[model samples]
Target: MNEIETAPSGEWQDVAARDQLDPDFPLGVEVNGQPIGLYLLGDQVHAIEDVCPHAEALLSQGFVENGVVECPLHGAQFDIATGKCLVEIGERDVRCFPVRVVDGRVSIKIVPV
Candidate 1:
């Protein structure tokens, strides 16, 4: 008998249409097996890593209050827009990704700088 293997699909699928994501609630989507936090702030969609750097916690699982994600583990806060760690004093920031919505589709660019 012979077996075949398949490659993983590309990331950034059209998880939600433009009409599905309301301006009031942020939408959470998984791309390439990674949790991506999506928020529509000021006519633009922002995507960030859903994991809190301080601990092994999912930011999406936490509460999204006032443009900041409060880490349910240690109560650390992170700025979703810039992926900046609010609790940490130094330049410890969470990973941020570029997001784009075209033709009523949402996509994420995870290219590192």
Candidate 2:
């Protein structure tokens, strides 16, 4: 399993390797002790909160169509790029993080809400 965990003192946390991630699937990782979903499209990577705000489902297990990820629990759709709740099932927006690739590894900058 990927070993992404809480970063110390709100620092950027190294989550996973670029080579280990599947471009079509969202990987669930932890950043600053919070669950985050990671997605790769072409050379770009995006990060969002992993849990669906509408229900108790992991966004990583959800389906990504176009730029939106549909929540598996209730079919709520969330935009991967901006973490917007496109379907409006929930008023809450998923927290998005700034991602970086350094030396073939992926790191995420956690921003507190």
Candidate 3:
């Protein structure tokens, strides 16, 4: 695990090491006190809000398959790369943060949704 770095709003903050992410699993992290999920798809990484809109469950803890994450609480699914809600139970699309990797560190720029 990597230590999360704090930064001002709208600025990129280091959340984890690039190697810490797994395609089969999502990493849950906090940036600016907001929950975010980090997912790896092929060679790219994506950051999205971790909380499920329908049940407030952590999406990072959900089952991930075919680039979709299913809510552990209510079976809602979301597209990992786009943060779009795939299942009706998801309620609405989640917020996505801009991500970048440098020196094996994963950083994300968080903005208010």
Q: Which candidate is the best by TM-score?
A: 3
Candidates sorted on lDDT, descending: 3, 2, 1
lDDT of 1: 0.67
Task: Give the local distance difference test score of model 3.
Answer: 0.90
Q: Where in model 1 is the C-alpha error above 4 Å? A: 1-13, 22-25, 89-91
State residue 6's C-alpha deviation in candidate 1, in Å.
11
lDDT of 2 by residue, 1-98 (tens): 24465667456788988886776788887655678888987788998888888776888888887888889888888888999888878558888889
- All candidates: TM-score: 0.72, 0.90, 0.94
Q: In model 1, how large is the Cα lDDT of residue 37?
A: 71
> What is the descending TM-score order?
3, 2, 1
Candidate 3, after superposition: displacement of residue 51 in Å?
0.3
For model 2 the local lDDT of residue 39 reads 93
Worst 10-residue stretch by lDDT in candidate 1? 1-10
Best model number under lDDT? 3
Clashes of each: 0, 0, 0
Compared to the true structure, candidate 1 yields what TM-score? 0.72
Clashing pairs in 1: none
